[model samples]
Target: MDSPPFESFSRVLSETIGPLFVSAIIGGALQGVIGGQAIYYFKYNKADPLVMKCLVLFVWVLNILHYFLVVDAIFIYTVNGHGDPSSVSRLTWSDIAIVLVSDTGDLAVKSIFSYRVWRLSRQWYLSVAIMTGALVTFSFSLYLTITMIQSPSVMPNAVGTFGALITLAISDIIMSVILAMVFWKRRSVFPTVNRVLRMVILYSLETSLVTR
Candidate 1:
């Protein structure tokens, strides 16, 4: 008639704490990269466009907020309420906030790349396609966030969340491929530029692989 002593704790670790820890580690590393980019931009590209500078600042702020939300959730559920059955029975607001902020950060980064794809390719059709995919991914992510907030347990929203993640991954792959193609096409035109473009392509692929 009674559950095992470790049942609640195991469920909580599997459903929330484990995933949050992994996410926090990866997100923290990414935020570090973004910080490095910010430093480089301010140091070497002082004359860059105002819009570009603003976008960088926006992403920095968004990612920081995301990291904060994730840390807060970990503190609330694992650190403060550790081994508490009531806390493990349902998802919390902090958990939902982490999802929301993480999705928002992803959207912001994808938007920047979408614009870069457009600027480099000078092709309206490709840009439109990438932008459309980004929007759809964002929509699904928003739906997932809403469902998580409404649901008592994460299991109920698993399918929706997985679908959104798949969509987001596909969108990222498509954008990376298109950007690589753009670089490849121009490599022949500018021999001296090929090395830089190759590095860019490799970096794009690297990030995409990490995300997947």
Candidate 2:
């Protein structure tokens, strides 16, 4: 029999593995904060050995996911496309699914940090409000991701790119505000939260350079 059609091959790669990689990177890093926080909390409190051990395991898993995400994105966007826009056609549904999952993972990470703030200051109201806002932001991101992929003709479109950038910028601002609040509410935890935010901002700047 003749080889399967181009569409079938494209569908297989884009749908099956594309999301896996993108989510791996995006989700992995977001979840990594959760893992890292757990580790630090247990260590500082001198918690049960079981909990400590589990944190270590989680760290490894999240790190692995981050690594795979990088590999997958590069492969799909560059190697597979082979210097031709025609090489990559429609955005498989999987692409949209990956973006949604990754963005949700981001919200989760933010909530986890906000909860940490609550623990530090017992500011339940602030934590709940921030968490709700984060959810809304992620929901919008998910919708935009779906729309962009569903309409492949919009790829590299200025409107879509701006939408994504605006969402991310808002997210970064929210994260910064949370960090500032945490820093002010509990001076003791300032160093930790501030350090993380600094690294996050620096990485974002570096990534922007590469993208440009």
Candidate 3:
């Protein structure tokens, strides 16, 4: 018997496709922002360190790869494996790949900010604390990826997933607060510095909203 209308499509939609679509859209926009920043960096910061330039290029490449993987997965489901029961019923390797790539991208971004926090505050202890949280989050993410690969038929452990998310959120919030405080402290030294710091503070808060 033929499957009910959208039975396969709806199953995939609810389980994976829909969320991936939304994420792709948002991630694409953020990737654009990063691209713009990269161009600006090259144009204005010619004297910046090679490591900093390479970091921007690395993030841009990862973001592009992440989006490409998502699109490829969607194509595989809707075109290559269209109406295949097996395809709609369980998570594919592509889905797992998306998760892994996303987690890696997140870690890269967080690590960059952790370094920024250290540079701004010059506080070794605070930098270590932030990186400790990041390391825990990365460990949990790795665990989730392994479990997903091992048991694609089963849902991931909710507690572990949520734990990783919570740790990431807390770490981001701490970093944002530290950055804001550092900017505030420097705001009094020079009027030009105060203006730049205000802009930095605003950007930090705006970026933090994504965590919410």
Question: Which pairs of residues collide in candidate 2?
Answer: none
Please list the residue runs of candidate 1 whose C-alpha ends up more than 4 Å from where it truly belongs after superposition. Answer: 1-3, 22-30, 154-156, 188-192
lDDT of 1 by residue, 129-189 (tens): 7777777877887787788777757554766688778888888888888888888887766
TM-score of each: 0.85, 0.53, 0.83
Candidate achieving higher lDDT, 1 or 3: 1
- List the candidates ranked by lDDT, beginning with the highest: 1, 3, 2
Query: Which lDDT value does model 1 have at 72?
Result: 84
Worst 10 residues of 1 by lDDT: 151-160
lDDT of 1 at 34: 78
Q: Which of the two candidates, 2 or 3, achieves a greater lDDT against the reference?
A: 3
Give the Å error, residue 175, model 3. Answer: 1.2
lDDT of 3 by residue, 1-212 (tens): 56675675677566777787787788778877878987897899888678767766777788888888888877777787776656665667777777667777777776677677677778877777767777788888888888888888888877668977888788777777777887787766678878988998989877876855
lDDT of 2 by residue, 1-212 (tens): 32455556567567845766665667656666766766676668664456435544554454555455556555665576754444455564444454555556556566565666677668787677667666766767656775676576556445545655666566556555655655554444567876776665566555544543
How much RMSD separates candidate 1 from the native structure? 2.6
What's the lDDT of the predicted structure labeled candidate 1? 0.78
Residue 192, model 2: Cα distance from true site in angstroms:
14
